[model samples]
Each structure stands twice: as structure tokens, then as C-alpha cells.
Target: MKLALSALGLAVLTGCAAVSPQQGVDRANDEAAGFTQGALNLARTQQERDDRAQKTQTLLSAPVGQKEAVQLALANSAALQALLAQGWVDAAGAAQLGRVANPVFSFERMSSGGSLDLGRALSFGLLDLLTLPARQGIATRRIEEAQLRLTGDVVDQVTAVRQAWVRAVAAQQTASYAQQVYQSAEAGAELARRMRAAGNFNRIDRAREQSFYADAATRLATARHQATASREELVRLLGLDEAQAGALRLPERLPDLPKQALEPQAVASLATRARLDIRLAQSALDSASKAQGLGVVTSFTDIELTGRRNTAFDADGTRSNARGWEIAVALPIFDWGGMQRAAMNGRTLAAANQLEATVRAAGSSLRQSYSAYRTSYDIARHYRDEVVPLRKLISDENQLRYNGMLIGVFELLADARDQVGTVLAALDAQQQFWLADAALQASVVGRPGGATVASPAAAPAESASAGH
Candidate 1:
């Protein structure tokens, strides 16, 4: 009885304990902060969610910048909240798997000729109890995997927000230039009409001016629509309502290019430590290895042990007691676990291959991202330093010639229109560079955003040549 009592005490103490999902969530938020530079959280209670909503309101109350936009999404996005809640459920389910199956209880009674007998039995899976520690290890690993996955998801979301902000702001700037071009064309067309009425301009020349005005109007319309569409895209990502969208204000232009491009060596170094894909793959491989080992014992056979007790009373008033235990083992005669073992082996092999593939691909992926980053930087820089300045100089010279009566008013108006087009192209180049920059940052951190570098806008010289 003493031995049994001691064993019972040990079993009770060693039983699996419940794990809180907050532990994993907190870990994920911490790791994600390094990449997103914003707070990520799971609002488990109504009060917590309300608090986040209030914070989101505060952010949207002002003109939202890129960083502020990320914060707003983190606070306001229902989808992100759902991801967190689902992550908790997944982690809790994994914890439950590590726990021992509930024990079975049985009771029996018999009465005959004034004799009474009772039996009680309690049973549980013996093998599961023996392997509880291994199962717990597997569960821990699964929780880590969940945390890493959450971090990766946050990184992706934040990257999207940044890129969306860039596009919206660039579109706004482009639309302004488009409007200027339209107004200039309208003025020139009106002047041509008046000159034609006075017999100073021919019909062909007047029609050419009208055609330019018509094209400018179309381009202006397209640009305005593009700006609205991009702004709405940002609004959706940030989870803003109509009122909040109205309050949102973007920068006048895209940010200037960085002073120096990221070095290839720096990118390679970050990829080695920061790649989440490789980390996830490695975690999966570890999980498969642990699972395969655990499966070997469970697939072969199962064991159930039961501690039983009985009592009996006779007609003469004499009482008796009985106590014993039973062990039930599954026999491996008719069905062996060949298929189970085969599946386990296959899973292990697949995991190994996946890890290898991720490792091999990581460097190449970083290299490609870096190439885009560098190329975009160069193109945008060229436009800023070479193309825009030359256009400005040419416009200045044309203005001077017009003042001297060396060029006609039509020639001056055309030059002004061309200069606006050059500015529009420059804005596009700047937007593409920033988008590429955001994508490169995401790739450096292990969640590849798959950012594509848009082709650089045609140079003003090229446009002039093509016209000739």
C-alpha cells in the first residue's frame, strides 16, 4: 500500500501541465518587433481589443506616415487578430496532444444467496505514460514553430503596408504633374484657336494643338484614377473607415534615395542569420525526427495497465478483500505497423530534403533581391542627378530664347509640356526604387516579399529622339 501510494503521488506530480498560448504570442511579438519596428499583439479579451481600437483611432486621427500606417494595421486589422487567435488555438491543441489520455474506470457488482461482491478497476495507457517526456519535447518544438510563423506573417503584413504607402504617395505626386500638363495644354489650344480665327495660324496647326490638349486630358484622367485607386488600396491595408481615409494625408513626394546602397556582403550576412524560411524548415525537420522516434514504439504495440480491487461478504457475516493489477498488451500477430513505419520514414526524408532546398536557395534569393535593389537605386539616382537637371536647363534656355523673340509661343508651350512629362517619369522611377527597397528589406529578414523592380522610365532624350 505504501509503494502504491508513492507511485500515485509521483504520477500526479509528473502529469502534463496546461500551457498558456500567451507565452507563444508574447515571444512572436518580441521577435516580430525587430523586423516590423511596430507592436504586434493578440487581444484576448474585449477590453484589450477595445484598447487596441482606441490606439488605432489615435493613429488615424492624424496624417498617417509609413511607420504610423504599420502601427495602425497592427492595431486595427481584424485579419491579423484572427491570425493571432488561430495561432493560439493551434498551440493549445498541440499542448493537448502532449497530455496523457484520460484513465478508464470500471465497476462490477454481484449478489447471490446473501453474498455481495464488488469490483473496481482503473486503467490508462502504460506506453503513453512511459513516453510523456518525449511527447512534451515535440510539443515545445511545435510551439516554437508557431511563434516563428506568426513573426513571418507580421513581417509580410508590415512590408505590404510600407509598399502601399509608397505607391499612394507617388501616384498623388504624378497626378499633380498630370493636372499641370493638362492646364498648360488647354491654354496652348485656346491660344491656337484664337490665332487661327485671326488667320495667324493654319487649320492643321490648330488641329495639332487640339489633339495635344485632348491627349493631355485623357492622361490627366488616368492619373487621377490611379491616385484614387492606390490611396484606396492603402486604406484597405490600414483598415481605415471612410472618415479615417479622409483624414489621411500622404507626403508630397517619395523619399529621396539612400546615400549608399546596401552592400552585397551585408545582405549575405543578414540572410544567413535572418532567413525565417530556413529556420522554419529546420524546425520542421527536427519535429519530424522526434515524431518518427516516438512513432516507432507506439506503432508496434500498445500497453494498458489497470489497478483493480474487490470486496465480498458471505452469509455468515464474514468479509474478504482482494486487490491486483492487470496489463493488457496488443499483439503484433495479424497486423504489423509496416505502413506506419514507411510513412514515418518518408516524412523524415521529405523534411530533410526541404531543409536542404531552403538552405541552397537562401543565398541565391538574397543575391537576386540585392541586384534589384542596386539597379533600382542606380536608375533612380540617374534620373534625379542627370535627367531632371538637364530638362530644367533646357527649359531655362528655351525660356530665355522666347524672351528674346527667338522661339515662337507654340515652341515654348511644347517645351513646357515636355518638361512636365520628364518630371512625371522621374516620379515613377523614384516610386519603383522605394518599392524595391521595401522588398529587399523584407527579403533580408527571411520572408521574401517577391518584390519586382519596374523598368526605368524612358529618358527625355530617348523620347525626343523617338519623336524625330
Candidate 2:
């Protein structure tokens, strides 16, 4: 009786030792502090919800930059909330593996020939108590895996918000430039039409001006739509309500490029530090190895123990009492648990190989992400320092010549169009750099954001041809 009571008490204590959902959430936030900026939260109560809503509202009232956008999404996004909730569920389920099943209770009463019999039994799985330590070790590893996964997920979400903000702001700047191009084309076409009416311009020149005006109009429309689409994408990422969306404002332009790009040596050092991917893989391998060992004994057989008490009363005023226990063990005659052992062995092997693969690929992924980031930064800097300035200088010279009557109005208008095209291309280069920067930030922390470096010259070349 003392032994049985002791085991039951131990099981109850083990059950109480599992981590609570709040603790899991707090752990994830701490581990992902770089991405979350210590702002990750789950609003479980009305007061929390209201506080989060107020924070989001305060952020939305400003021209949301990259960091503000991430903050807004953390506070407002329903998808992010669902992700945290699922993380809590996974952690709780993993903790359950460490707890023993509740003991079963049975009762019976029988009457025959003026005699009554009463019986009671309490039964539980004995192997579960024996394997408690091993199971708890596996549960601890699984919980660690859950926390790392949540951290990686938060990094991914924040990277997405950063990239979307870049796109939204860049699109707005591009659209504003497109409007300038349209106005320049409109003026050139109008002047050409008046000159042709006065027999001062040729039909071919007038037609060319009109065609350029039409093309500019089309480009303007496309740019406007692109701006709208990018803004809406940011709005969705932020999980804003209709009212909040209506109130949302974005920065006027993308941030300027950093004075110096990230150093390769610095990137290498950061990549070598503890990464979420490597930790997760190691945790998985540990769990599989633990579980494999645990299955060796459990798969072959199981044992159950039951304690019982019985009392009987006879019609002749005679009574009897009995107290004892029962033991049940499963036999491995027809099934030797061979298949179960094989499955466990296979899982361990797979986990080992997966960890190796993750370790091997980590450096290469970081290098590729850094390459894209550095290349984008260089191209954007070139445009800002060389291309845009040269175009502006030419525009100024043309304006001076036009004022001195050394160039016609048509030549001055053409120069203006070329300068606007160059500026638009510069805007695109800046946008790509910001996107790549966001991706590199994620990759440094072991989550890749898939941003790539695009050709910085493509837009400007196309623009030059269109102007001609």
C-alpha cells in the first residue's frame, strides 16, 4: 500500500512540473530578442488586447518606417497571434510526454443468496513510472525545439515586414517620379503640336512627341497601381482593420544606403555564432536519440499493476475480508516489436543526417545572402554618387544653354526627361538595396528571407531608350 501510494504521488508531482504556456512564450521572446526587439507578446486578456491595440494605433499614426512597421505587425497581426498560440500548444503537448497517465479506478458490487460482495481496484501502467526520467529528457529537448522554431518564425515575420515597408516606400517615390515624367511629356507634346500648327515643326517630330506622351501616360498608370499594390501588401502584413488601414501612412522614401557595407569578416563571425537552424537541428537529433533508447525496452513489452480490496457478508452472520494486488505483463510471442525498433532506429538515423546537412549548408546560405546584400549596396551607392549626379549636371548645362538661346525648347525638354528617368532608376537601386539588407539581417540569425540583387542599370537603360 505504501509503495503504490508513493508511485501515485510521484506521478502527480511530475504532471505538475510541466512548463506553463506563458513561460514558453516568454522564453521564445527572449531567444528572439534581435528580431522581436523585446516586443513580442501574446494578448490573452482584454487588458492586454487593449494595450496592444493602443500601441498599434500609436504606430499607425506616424509615417511608419522599417522598425515601426515591424512593431506594428508584432502588436496588430492576427496571423502572428495564431502562430504564438500554436507554439504554446506544441510546447504543452511535448510536456505531456513526460507525465504518467492517470490511474484507473474500478468498483463492483454483487448480491446472491442473501450475501453481498464489494470490490475496488486502482490500476496504472508500471512501465510508465520506470521510464519517467527518459521521457522527461526527451520532453525537455522537444520543448527546446519548439522555442527555437518559434524564434525562427518571428525572425521570418519581421523580415517580411521590413521588406514590405521598403517596397511600399519605394513605390511611392517611383510613382511621384512617374508623375513628373508624365508632366514633362505632356509639355513637350503640347509644344510640338503648337509648333506644327504654325508650320515650325515637322510631322515626324510632332508624331514622336505625341507617342512619347502616350507611353508616359501608360507608365504613370502602371506606377500608380504598383504603389497601391505595395501599400496594400504592407497593410495586410500589419494585420490592420479597415479603419486602421485607412489611417496608415508610409515614409516618403527608402532609407539612404549605409556609408559602408557590412564587412565579410564581420558577417563570417556573426554566422558562426549560435544560429537557430543549428540549434534546432541539434535539439532534434538529441530528441530522436533519446527516444530511440527509450523505445528499446518499452516496445518489447508492457506491465500493469493493480491493487485491490474485497469484502463479503454471508446470510449466517459470517464476514470475510481480502486485500491483495495483481500484476499483468504483455508477452512478445506473436509480435517481437521488431518493427517498432526499426522505426525508431530509422528516425535516429534521419535526424543525424539532417543535422549534418543543416550544418553543411549554413555557411553557404549566409555567404549567398551576404553577397546579394553587398552587391546591392554597391550598386545603389554608385547610382547615388555617379549616375544621378552626372544626369543632374547635364540637365543644368542644358537649362543654361536654353536660357542663352543656344538650344531649342525641344532639346531642353528632352534633357529634363532623361534626368527624370535616371532619378527613377536610382530610386529602384535604393529599393533593391534595402530589400537585400532585410534579407541579410534574417540570414545572419539563421532565417533566409529570399531577397535577391537585381541589375541596377536595367531601368535606366530602358528609360533612356524610351526618352529617345
Candidate 3:
């Protein structure tokens, strides 16, 4: 009896202690910061929320870099906050499931012929108390799964914010060049019109120049809209209010490509170490296995232990007290829980299969993301080292020729326009490289976030002589 009472005391102590979700959230935030170089947090109080808002305001007060953009999104995004809050709730619920149910109490009173009786009883689920340890293990696994999921989600969100900032800044850069191209086209068209009036240019030639101007105008309009759209997309991701949006700014261009690309072996190693999806699957499998074992006993039978006491009075003024204990067990004579066991078996099998699938997919995803990262880096470098420089050389030569009266001004203007176009293409390549960089970082942490690299825009084919 002493041993049994000691065991019950231990179980009650284990079950009565409240579980906190903050620990899991803090672990996830720390892991995410290690992987993504950004911090994540849950603002559970008004003070925390206010502090985050202040930080966001400070970040938005200037031209935000890619890292700053990620920080801003982490601090300000309502959707991300909601996800964190939900994760906490899920973890708390899982903890609740690990605890034993509350004990039940009952009372009764009866009176007849000057006789009175009083009774009291207390009951609790014996099976739940006995299975508390196994249930707690399952709950722990569930909490671990939630933390990994939260880490993966933070990776995804930070990657998205980084990529969006890249596109927005790149769009703005492209739009500026497009405006330059438009101005050059307008000047060339005006010159051709003047030359046509002076009978120095043919009607066909002037029409061609006018056509180029029209195309340039249309391109400029498209570029402007693209810039606005991409900027708004970033704004939404950062969860900026109207006042914050007004203060938000971005760098004029994407950052330069890194000197060296990430080695595939290193990336693969990191993916293997930090793959949250695989960890989550493993947790699920473990939980399923434990639950399956627990179901074997629980599904077939349930036991409730009750302690009772009563007092009775007779009409002759004699009183008596009675004390006893009752045990209630669900009889499994009719149903043997065969279907429940089968379901548990099926769940275990599914969990095992899912774990295998996640493990297999992790390698493939990492490889694909690395490939995109390397390819985009190469393309962007090529544009920076070869294409833009070549265009610049051609433009410089054309300018010299025009100064020496060996080339027409129209030729110089057209060369300048083509140079701007080439720079625009290079800007686009840089953007793709940065985006791929962000995606690869996410993939390394086991959350593959981006798809394919964007193709570079084609340069204009018509030379300056075509308008002549």
C-alpha cells in the first residue's frame, strides 16, 4: 500500500505541473537564428508588441538592405505572428493531452422516518494514471515536432522577404534605366523629325525613329508598373501600415554576387544535419509507435477507482459509519478492440513510410536548390564581367566617334540606349542570383523555398543604323 501510494504521488506530481510553450518557441527562435541569420520571436504581451513595433519603425526609417528587410518582416508581419501564436497553442494543447484527467467527486444525502444518511465518493481514471509516462513521452515528441515546424516556417518567411526585397530594388533600378532609354528614344525621334522637316531625312526613316520612341514609352510604362507592383508586394510582406509604408525605402540595386559559390558537399552536409522535415517525420513516427503500444491496453479496457464513505442514523439514536472502495472496469466481452488495434497498426505504418519519403526528398531538394544557386551566380557574373563591359566599350567608342564628327548624334544616342538595355539585363541577372542565394540558404536549413531562376531579358536587336 505504501508503494502504491508513492507511485500515485509521483504520477500526480508529474501531471499537475503546468507545461509552458515558451520554451519550445524560444528553442525554435534560437535554431532559426542560427540557420537564417535572422531572429524570430513571439510577441505575447503588449510591451513586446510595442517593442517590436518600435524596432520595425527604426528599420523602415531608412533604405532597407536585404538583411534589414528580413528583420523588418520578422518584427512586423502579422501573418508570421499568427503562425507563432498558433504554434504555441498547439504545443499547449499537446501538453494538456499528456496530463491526467481531473478526479471526480460525488455526494448524496437521504432522509426517511427520522433517519438520515450521508455519503461521499471520489473517483479517477486508473488507466490514465498508469499510462501517464507513455502519454507524456508522446506529448514531448509532439512539442518537438512543433518547434521544428516553427523553425522551418521562419526560414521560409525570411527567405521570402529577402527575395521580395531583391526583386523590388531590381525593379526600381530597371525602371530608372527604362526611363533613360525612353528619353534617348524621344531625343532621337525629335531629331529625326527635325531632320525630316529640313529634308535631310526620309519619311521612312523618321517613321522608324518614331516607332522606336513609341516602343520605348511602352517599355517605360511597363517597367514603372513592375516597380510599383514589386514594391507593394514587399510592403505587404513586411506588414507595413500606411505610415510605415511611407517611410519604407529600398536600396537602388541588388547586392553584388558573392566571390565564391557554396560548395555542394557543404550544402548537402548542412541539409542532412538541419532538415526539419525529416526531424518532424521522425517525431511523428516515434509518437505513433508509442501511441500504438498505449492503445493496446486502453482500447480494450478502462478502469476507474473510487473511494467512498457514508454515515447512517437510526430512529433509536444509534449512528454507524461505513467506508469502502469500488473498482469499475469496462468489460471487453462484447468488443475486443480489433478495429482499434488495426487502426493503430495502420497509423504506425503510414508514419514510417512518411519518414522514409521525407528523408529521400531532402537530398533531392537540396541538390536542386544548389544547382539553381550556382547557375544563377554564373549567369550574373558573366553579365557583369562580359556583357555590360562590352556594351560600355561600344558606347564609349560611339561617343568618341561622334565627338570627332565621324558618327552622327543619333548613332550615339542609340548606342547609349542599347547600353542601358544591357545594364537592365545585368540588373535582372543580379536579382535572380540574389533570389537564388536566398532560396539556397533556406534549402540548406531543410526548407526549400524558391522554384526556378528567371531567364534574362533579350537585348534589343536593331542597331543605330537601322533607324538611318
Candidate 4:
């Protein structure tokens, strides 16, 4: 009875505590500070909503940078709020497992031939009381798992926002360049027409020039549409309403690549601490191992204890009272809980293997992400320092040669046309570098966003157009 009272007191203390959604959001903000930029919130009131809206507006008032975009999404996204709420719900459910069910009370009364009888009983699950401490341990691990999941999910969401912002800004930059290319092609085509009419340019050369102009127009249209699509995608990820969508602005260009790529040792150091996947898997294994141990006793049978009191009265006004305790154990004669024990064993084994798998894969995934990052950084740097400058040099020399009358205007125009592909390809390389950078940030935190490299020949088909 003393032990029962002690366990009941423990259960009462654990049961009365409430789980707060803001707590989970705050935890995520702390754990995923790099991804969330420490701006995560869950607005449960009108005041908070207004404050969040104002913050989002302030962010959208300027051209959204990569980090600012992630901050805005954390502040404004309803889906993110739902995620926090769901995490709270999961945490509460896990906490519920640590508490014992309320004790049951029973009452009965009967009268026969002026004789009266009354009975009362109180009952509870004895197994639940005995296992309270173990159950609480399991609940603690599950709650930990929930928090890690919340942090990992926030990291993924913020990583997506960052990548989308990069794509949108890059697409906007490319579109502007495409427009410039189209205008230049149009001018060259008109000049070619005039030269051909004056009999200074051949029919085939004029046709090629016109074909280039047509292709440029097509490419410009595609680029504009691509820009629109990318911007809309960003808007969606940021959870913008119609007014907010209209007010959205993206940077005119992708940010310049870092001067130096992250060192391998630095990356290893970053990934070594608090990786979400490994921690989550370890939490699962802990919960499963604890639950399996508890299941060994619970799966075979259940024990219930009841305290009973009875009273009887005769017609002569005499009364007698009876009091005792009863212990009930479930009979496992026909159906033992073999399947329940088997399932628990299987889950424990699965969790152990999963932790091992995550441990083995973590380093490899980080390496792949780093490789993509470095490769992209190198390619973009090569274009910036080598290919683009070489193209500009060629264009400038051609213009000087034309001024000296060593080359015809047609040849000068052809040289300019050839430079278009190089410029666009350089833009593509820069875009991939930024995207890879975003993915690498995510992978370091253990949420493996892919960082696939674009092919070297990412320029449009018109870049390969024939030149005379």
C-alpha cells in the first residue's frame, strides 16, 4: 500500500504537467539556428499574428536575400506553425504514456424483504503502477525524438527556402541577360538585312543572322517564363498570400561565390556534433530497448487490484460491515501475448539496425554534399576568372579590329554572337554554386538536401547557333 501510494503520487505529478507548443518551437529555433536564423515562432494570438505580419512585411520590403527569405518563411508560413503544433501533440502523447490511468470506483445497493445490502469498490491496474518509472523513461526518450524531428524538419524547410531564393534570383539575372542578348541579335539581324539589300552580305549569311535573332527571341521568352516560375515557387515556399506575393522582390543577382571553399576538416568538425539523424535514431533505439524490457512482463498477463467494502442490515436494525482486498490476474490459458512480445522484439532489433545504418551513412552523405559544393565552387570560379574574361577580351579585340578595317562588321557581329553562350553558361555555373552551398549547409546539420551539379554544357541551344 505504501508503494502504491508512492507510485500514484509520481503518476499524478507527471500527469498534471502540460506540453507547450512554443517550447517546441523555441527548441527548434535553438537547435536549427543556422537554418532558421533563430527567427522561428508560433503565433497563437492576434497580437502575435500582427507582429509576425509586420516582421514579414519588413523583410519583404527589401529585396529578399537568402537568409532573410528563410527568416520570413519561419515567421509567416502556416505550414510551419502546423508542424510545431503537431510536434506538441506528439510530445503530449508521449507524456501521456508516462501517466497511469485514473482509478475506477464502483457502488451498488440492493434491498430484499426489508433487509438492505450495500457494496463499494475501488480498482486500478497493478501492472501500470509497477511499471510507471520504466514507462516514464521511455516517454522521455520519445519526447527527445519528437524534438529532434521538429528541428530536422525545420532545417529542411529553411534549406528549401534558401535554395528557392537562389534559384529565383539567378533566374531573374539570367532573364535580364537573355533580354540583352535578344536585343543584340535583333540589331545584328537588321544590320545583316541592310547589308544584304546593298549586296554587301550574302543570302546565306543574312539567313543565319535572322535565324539567330529568331532563336534569341525564343530563348528570351523561355527565360522570362522560367523567372516567373521560379519566383512563384519561392512565393509558395514562403507561404505568401496574394498581396504578399505581389509585394515580393528578389535580388537582381545571385550572391558571389565564397573566396575559399570550406575546408574538409571544418566540414568534418561541423558534422561531428549533434547530427539530427544520428541523434534521432539513437533516441529511437533507446525507446525501443526500454519498451522491449517492459513488454516482457506486460505481454504475458495483467494484474488488477481492488479494495472492497460491504454492509448488510436486518429488519431488526442490526448492521454488519465487511472489508477486504481482491487481486485479479488475467488467465493466459488459451491465448498468450506471444505476438505482442514478438512485435516488441522486432521493433527493438529494427531500431538497433537503423541506428547503425544512419551512423554509417552520415559521413558518406556529408562527403558527397561537400564534393558537390567544392566542384560547383571551382566551376563557377573558373568561369568568373577565365571563361568570361576571355570572352570579353575576344569581343574587345574584334571591335578594335573592325575599327582598323581589318575585319568586316559581319565578322565583328559574329564574334559577339559567339560570346553569348559563354556568358549564359557562366551564369548557370554561378547558380549551381549557390544551390550547392545551400545543400551543403543542410547536409552539415544532418538533413541531406541533394547538391547535384549541373552539366558543363548548361547553355541554351541558341548558344550553338551557326556563325558566318
Off by over 4 Å in 3: 1-12, 15-18, 35-38, 269-274, 333-335, 460-464
| C-alpha lDDT of residue 308 in model 3 | 92
Write down the lDDT of every candidate, Cα atoms only. 0.81, 0.85, 0.83, 0.86
lDDT of 2 by residue, 1-468 (tens): 786787778867587538766776687678777778778888899999999999998998888889999999999999999989888888888888888888889998999998999998889899988998899999989988887898788888888898999999999988888898889889889998999999988887788778879888988899999999999999999999899999998878787788899899988776637888899999999999999999999999999999899999998868999999999999999998999999999999999999999889888888889989998888889988999888888888988988998888887776776676678768888998889888998888888666578865334222222221
Sort by lDDT, best first: what order?
4, 2, 3, 1
Report the C-alpha lDDT of model 1 over 1-468, residue by residue, as the tens digit: 865784675467345545576775676666666554546777878998889878977886777777887888888887777777887777777676677777788999999999999999888888988888888888777766777787788788888888999999999988888888889889989998999999888877787778888888988898899999999999988877787778788878777888988888877776648468888888888888998999999899999999899999998889999999999999999878989989999999999999999889887777777888888888889988999999999999989998998888888877876776578777888898888888888888787766667865543321121111
Pairwise TM-score winner, candidates 1 and 3: 3
Q: Report the Cα lDDT for candidate 3.
A: 0.83
What are the per-residue Cα lDDT tens digits for candidate 3 across 1-468?
854695588577566434565665677666776544546777889999999999998897889998888888888999888878888877777777688887888999999999999999888898988898888888888777777777777777777888888889999998988898889889899998999999999987788789889988998999999999999999999999998998998888777788888888777666657577888899889989998999999999999999899999998889999999999999999999999999999999999999999899888888888889899899999998998888878888888888999888777776676676577678878888888888888887778764577788876656446444
Candidate 2 collision pairs: none
Better of 3 and 4 by TM-score: 4
Instruction: Output the worst ten-in-a-row residue range by lDDT, candidate 2.
Output: 459-468
In candidate 4, what are the lDDT values of residues 1-468, reduced to their tens digit? Answer: 864895678667567434677777888888887777677887889999999999999998998888888888989998888888888998888778888878888998999998999999888898888988899889888888888898888888888888889889988998999999899889999998998899987888888889889989998999999999999999989999999999898778888888899999998888747799999999999999999999999988999999899999998989999999999999989869899999999999999999999999888889999999999999999999999999899899989988998888777777887887888889889989888988998899888876799886455444333344
Separately for all candidates shown, the number of backbone clashes (residues 3 or more apart, or on different chains) is 0, 0, 0, 0
RMSD in Å for all candidates: 3.2, 2.3, 2.7, 2.4
Off by over 4 Å in 2: 1-4, 460-468
